[model samples]
Target: MQSDPHHDSANSVELPTPTAWPIITAFGLTLLFLGLVTTLFVSLAGFLLGLIGAIGWFGDVFPHPKHEPFPIRPHDEWPKDVCRVGRTVTHLHVGEHGHREQFPAAVHPYTAGFIGGLAGGAVMAVIACAWGYLVDQSLWYPVNLLAAAGLPELSTASTEVLKQFSLAGLVVALITHVTTSVLVGLLYTVLLPMLPAKREWIWGGILIPLMWTGLIWASLRFINPTLNARFEWLPFVISQIAFGMVCGFYVFRSTKVSTQQGWTVAARLGVEAQHPGEKKP
Candidate 1:
């Protein structure tokens, strides 16, 4: 009663649908553009942090299995189940020719991490920009600057004196970088999955605006009006559309590429795998 490796488990005779590429290409192009647009503001650190998250997510997926593909026995007699959790696959059966991806399942960890972090960073960049505007006003900046900056913190300087020094401005900048980095990294690791998959069309589209708007709104509602005045509250979510679109394109294309290349989507639910260390195939 085992199924053919070439066929899908659902129908026993059907090939799993190949992924659609148009969506992916569009998404990737969109991201590249968004990355360009965001070069205007935000620290580079946020993108770097987001990249780490992405790399980690992609690297451990579908490790290389060592066992050869099954069916040293007849196709019908091949062992249907080979993969288990925490197992490492080093080989795979590719159309009767034993082939391999030539890399560990952890391939491109840094690249994935970098890109994921970039996205995470981009989002946080927005939040930071929005929130920074709120934080930059009046006494708050001076207080935080004195505490966070080196010279100001070490010196018994008056608030007026501290405001004139380089340390205060530097501290604010450092705080900005740290806040974006952490926020973006957290966004990638924690928030990304909570939303629907990136290409869910209706949900994905609406979520972009909804999220940015909420962040912007939250910034305004909580903060003093004086600070909010400095913030450039451009169509709030208009920029986020580019971000969302970019993420969408990656999800669509990367997913398709994985399928076309005989890989499974890491984000998919309960999908089984066939690793290389099997005794039968």
Candidate 2:
């Protein structure tokens, strides 16, 4: 028999094994989309299954009394120099005595993203006003178009008459535009935390905005005939792209996670920053 120098049964950790909850949740979402194309029964079934799967997944993600608290790997056990979660970067550093410490880049992203969206919307509104002034000779022309969604009569208002500000139109337009901006900002906060830090633009800027624009253009007539009739491709494209960039700005740079607690979160998320034995980091 070999003598052991280091052995501690009490401090030994207990981790959860691999789970199929994610697969189940994915299957549920797939059915939900399929239900959109098929029947209500199918959709309902999908929704129920997805809800169950999601609950299970969440349960698995959060710590349970059965599982031991997560333990950090020692300095010599680290696999990489850096690992990123959301926008937080965990730098694995070794000290003089070979003690390891994780330095995380901390930030608050949701508020920043919302603020960025508001700023971006203001910029877009200004640009729209400029376009209206130069081309239509009416500062109120752009706002009136948004107002026309609810007040159909504004669609046919003469340029001369529309040049003067319509209080109703301004109110409607501001409400419509600001609401859309806030919704998109909220979406950014949700999605940024779920995506890889390096591919922020791919999902946040290019893909999501492009997909949203296409959907909007395709459904414009059905969504709002008055606005559809007056849609201009140039300004629409510019504004969408600008909005995405501005939204991506805050989401990419401002999200943060504490390295210690974040390690467990990253592990649960199946991010590349997980510990060596469980998965590749």
Candidate 3:
């Protein structure tokens, strides 16, 4: 007797059964970490939940994986296609210009990013200094605060000490500020092109600043307790916005270069042989 093909196909189409063990394990892990911030009781509860979940999850697969048989519908019960057919599909060659469907076919050069970063950093410094002078009556206060991230001495220094100028603080602040600005500027070059063209400015200038500010606000306590203690949210936010706006505008105005994504590795490395008839200019 011949076996029924449909029956065999249906029997072979077994899928893994849905289980709550994974979610339970995830919740357990979350609580376990959250306990670091809260209390040991939560961690104990999480450990119990995690152990139970792990045991149950392993039981599903130890000897044999658990699966459920999926019901197969007859061909006659399948939905009919209503869309038009036989439309010609256009094929793209790998080396062809603008053949990629992904956004950002081009990007600003590294030079542009570097210059933009410097410009933005200058603007940000100006704003920060102004805030320092206006609010703390000292031009060195903000600089000292920034340097405190690296200088442990400054971290514990008195408010009066922060207000006084220190050559070491100035050097540290300048280096930190420049390095961070340039890195963020390079990131902007990569990010801005992926955003909607019309809304790039809004995202780069306002939204991005606010987002990083929130992140810094949350993490600052652990990263630098001193800066977190004396940190003024308003001034810091303003300086960040100023940096973003200046950097974004500069990069936006700079000329973009085609990405070499479509080029062959040899061509990108300038090792591809030129065509016989091609003239070197």
Candidate 4:
């Protein structure tokens, strides 16, 4: 047996494992590389998206903007139901209300919508029909393209028809978003159900008459921008109550059986149905 030399030193220090340093260094480098790659990717995507958006906006856009929120419980009402529910949302969340609720986004978009009444309401003051005409042009461009490519129904007269549709859709979407956004929170959520308790639609999907036939009335009787006298404040107020009884009744009529994915439901009588995952109170 070989004898060890000085094996009983009182102040000996143990050495760390050799592989630990390399592993730690490798982890740090990997984190740094991942951060760099993510940053670069985001920057590139943002730049490309901005460039494309700018090009599209250079001329015009129909602005068929629509957005819907995830319902308080949305799973109960999608995928297959063809019915409608709910009504036009006229109010949006404003700062004061949100401060009270301690919510994010500063605004509740449910009824008020994405743009609400802001974009067009601002643009209309400065540009007049130029914006409207551009909007009209945008709405119909798809149809014109189809026609130009020789769609059987519209190959010959696609341009004229497309122009009309563009003009109409632009007029409608803009007015709807704006008039609704002018308020202070969603009026209500629209829903359409297909069964007593099975499926529902989040937005009711009603193409409520937003600005139909009323623009001419407003311009002729309301706005006088040259004299600086338009129904500038009136359109905002006129749309306040967003109640179309027709729509209300239609949505109410479409109720379905509220299932697990839908609203809280009970049976048809005095007895209560136990919730899937709850214990008796």
Best by lDDT: 3
Q: Write the per-residue lDDT of candidate 1 for residues 54-147, one digit (tens) a residue.
A: 4543443325211223223356776788767896766666433235533222222233434644564465455544443464433333333323
**Model 1 scores what on Cα lDDT?**
0.43
How accurate locally is residue 136 in candidate 1, as Cα lDDT from 0 to 100? 44
RMSD of 4: 25.2
Clashing pairs for predicted structure model 3, backbone only: none
Sort all candidates by TM-score, best to worst: 3, 2, 1, 4
Q: Give me the runs in candidate 3 sitting further than 4 Å from their true place.
A: 1-105, 264-281
Which residue ranges in model 1 land beyond 4 Å of their true spot?
1-114, 119-167, 174-182, 189-194, 197-206, 219-226, 246-281
User: In model 2, what lDDT does residue 263 have?
Assistant: 43
Model 2 is weakest, by summed lDDT over 10 consecutive residues, at 1-10
Candidates' C-alpha lDDT:
0.43, 0.71, 0.82, 0.35
Residue-pair clashes per prediction, in order, are 24, 0, 0, 23
Q: Which ranges in model 4 have alpha carbons more than 4 Å from their true place?
A: 1-18, 21-228, 232-242, 261-281
- Candidate 3: tens digits of C-alpha lDDT, residues 139-175: 9999999999889889989999989999999999999
Candidate 2 per-residue lDDT over residues 1-281, each given as its tens digit: 01221332454545554688889899988999999998978889989999999999888767642244346567588687775656854544442321233332233456876887787688778878888888778888888877877776676676555677999889989999998887788778666656766777777777777888899999988766766877788877777777887877766677464344334556658775654432112
Which is the winner by lDDT between candidate 1 and candidate 3? 3
Comparing 1 with 2 on TM-score, the higher-scoring candidate is 2
Write down the lDDT that model 4 would get: 0.35
What does the lDDT read for residue 135 in candidate 1? 48
